[model samples]
Target: MLFEDPVFASRMLSLLTLSIHAIFATLGVGLPLMIIIAHWLGIKKNDEHYLLMARRWARGFVVLVAVGVVTGTAIALQLALLWPNFMEMAGHVIALPLFMEVFAFFFEAIFLGIYLYTWNRFDDQRKHLLLLIPVAIGATMSAFFITTVNGFMNAPTGFQIIGGQMTGVSPIEAMFNPATPTKAAHVISTAFMTSAFVLAALAAYRLLKGAQHVYYKKALHLMMVVGLIFAIATAVIGDFAGKYLAKHQPEKLAAAEWHFETMEGAPLVLFGILDDEQNVRFGLEIPYALSILAHNHPQAEVIGLNEFPQEWHPPLFIHYLFDLMVIIGVWLVLFSFVYWWGMRRKWTIVTSRWFRRLIVASGPLAMLAIQAGWWMTEFGRQPWILRGVMTVEEAATQSPYVGHLFFFFLALYLILVIGVVVVLRNINQRFPLEQDLAHEGGERPWIT
Candidate 1:
């Protein structure tokens, strides 16, 4: 038996469940925003292909968003039960944000339901276009509100703990936590980026297969443009976030870089083995990279993980996660830029087999990057539910039956995973071949 500490095991399980839950979250929060935007454009251009794609995407969004809501509700309840101390402290500190999140959720649900049902209700183009605005607005608000909760967790503002009881909580401080703006921008932009790439991948895959459809080509091109622009923009914002963390959370930056010395001109580790006792990543190095990244000066002193106590340091596993995210992010930017350039040059992308294969691969690559980035954030914040305020051990539920809780969450998520796959497959089947459409009798000329 591993004989892990109960608190540690609980934290691990919490991370696992939350991570799985959030995969649906990005899709839920992001897909709807893009769908509404595409739908609006479709209406404006009076383009049937755009309208068809939007309707198709909306259906998938409806199913996945429903699952996301359910899973998110579970996570919320689990948070309170799994860490009562954390709930007590954070509930008081960030109550306003949590309350506001409820409103955002309600807004999203209402607008999404309307969009799903009233596809043909509004004959007037302008009024129908107006419907998409609420959907986009709701999605954006939902994403921002959720990030407010996470930002509070990271910066832990809005309240003080006196003798273990929260006191003098301030809603404004919680909403405007130090991490609020940065984390919100980072998360929302990345969501947009992910949605774009995923859409592009699907469209490109069909186009490359010689589907002989105009719908797929136009959709892929637009999606490619959106994905490329946002992916690059997200990277720029992430760089700013990296600098902000270096200034405010040096330990996290150090752990991410696997730096072992607090010194000038620290070389970043491209790949190395961590010698925990010696407190260094041995073998390989990239000269002066850490110094440049941290301080914009090659000789500027950059702190290292070794400066912190062993118990306090984030695990090496999270360092690898952070690295994977960065590496994949770079690849996405490069690939997206090239793909967009090809589109500008008159859609050479569809004709190139190799490029088409790469496009199909881009969806999974971007998804992997998003997952790794989140792991870096949550896992990198180790031992602290609220950074510097409360340790994970202090906040963990005292019950030893956490194993049972873990299995329950595990089983629930497993069902959700199966449901998502089945639903997506059914949605995919909705977009049929022209031959299939012909076979269905020309009565229903519309693809739907």
Candidate 2:
């Protein structure tokens, strides 16, 4: 017989899977653009070092893609088994994107194989680079379609729930819901930003370990530029996301800001602890900042938690997730900006051992920020699996097996992580940077 109290177990299992899957999925979405650019640069400059960077990144990306596919499949299964009610209802109005995502995944997979194996088949490296265009497109589209489903959950438009049945369904409207553009853009931009920093961290570590090479410098510089561009885009889109919350999901916005009273000229709370009584403690209070962020006007009215029932309020701790994401976004902007400027000024500080340590640290921090942002989004929508439509309790599976399944998947993720580390370490050992450089003047078997 199925257990009735499986909501918590199911929720935890899904959270664990998504969190682990995030690492590989983020790279799958972002690494292709970088690979294509690096390959293009290699061809343009006729530089063996750049070619080596592209080849190395591509090989590692293949491993990530494999693991990502496995975890992605796990997510797919969990959606049907764990949230059958939500899917059954959503399948009527929001199934288009979910169906399209499968095609997108295959498109990406097909081109990735072609790109990987045909590295040296064409005389023109540019022609080889051309194959990655489809790969990038497929990866980007996959993220786009999946995010649209998330967007629909947030907005829940395109259909009417009449007598507990969906009516007036329009899949197109659900796909083009108000939340899709900002959410999709933000997800893509941050994925690119996080991936760049992770790769840049590798280069920084190389330099820190006394690996004296111009290749690391070039690699770091390229990633810094890419990181800077996308980081700025993330901030801009994040602002739009704020505006979206204020207009469409005011309760979530209110909870994230610790706004307890609905009023104009609201203050923004920064890094505060919520007391047992729900009061802000030790927070930096910026007068009218919340109003401005929500409505582009300092005097505009901002909603608050009091506007909804106590049960409707999301956890107050999510404010920390919101703050962490903002802080990290700003930090990366400053870090990448200063690095790029320092290079232009030819300052020794830019290449200092301590500075490289900071660079190595930034990569993990960027990913940490990504997790915080995603958590903030998911947690802010508390109680409701689809805002105003279905509660999590209503959507979660009644199966007792969820608890056991969580442990099983947790072990699977650990094994996958160990396998990836072993494979990547072996690849690095088998084809060291110095070894590749030594053979640059001769026939390059590494190309195959």
lDDT, candidate 1, 1-448, per-residue tens = 2214568657767777777767777877678767766777877897766766776787778777788888778778878877888887777666677777778878878876776667556667567657667776777787798888887777777777789787888888888888888788988888888888888888878877777687777777788778878888888888777776777777888877877679998887755666737455454577987888787888989987778887768766777777777777788888878877766676765458788778788887878888888888877787688889888878888777777777777898898889889978976776564543353323333224
Which regions of candidate 1 are displaced past 4 Å? 1-5, 208-210, 276-284, 346-350, 430-448
Clashing residue pairs, backbone N/CA/C < 3 A, model 2? none
What's the lDDT for residue 283 in model 2?
A: 99
lDDT of 2 by residue, 1-448 (tens): 2323589888888898888888889988999999988988998999878888888999899989999999999999999999999988887676689889889999999999988888667877888888999999999999999999989888988999998888899999999999999999999999899999999999999988888889988999999899999999999999999999999989899989999999999999999787878788899999999999999999999988998998899887789999999999999999899999999999999888889999999999999998898888988999899999999989987787888888888999999999999998988888889888887767666744
How many angstroms is residue 166 displaced in model 2 relative to the true structure, after the best TM-score fit? 1.6
lDDT of each: 0.76, 0.90
State TM-scores per candidate.
0.91, 0.97
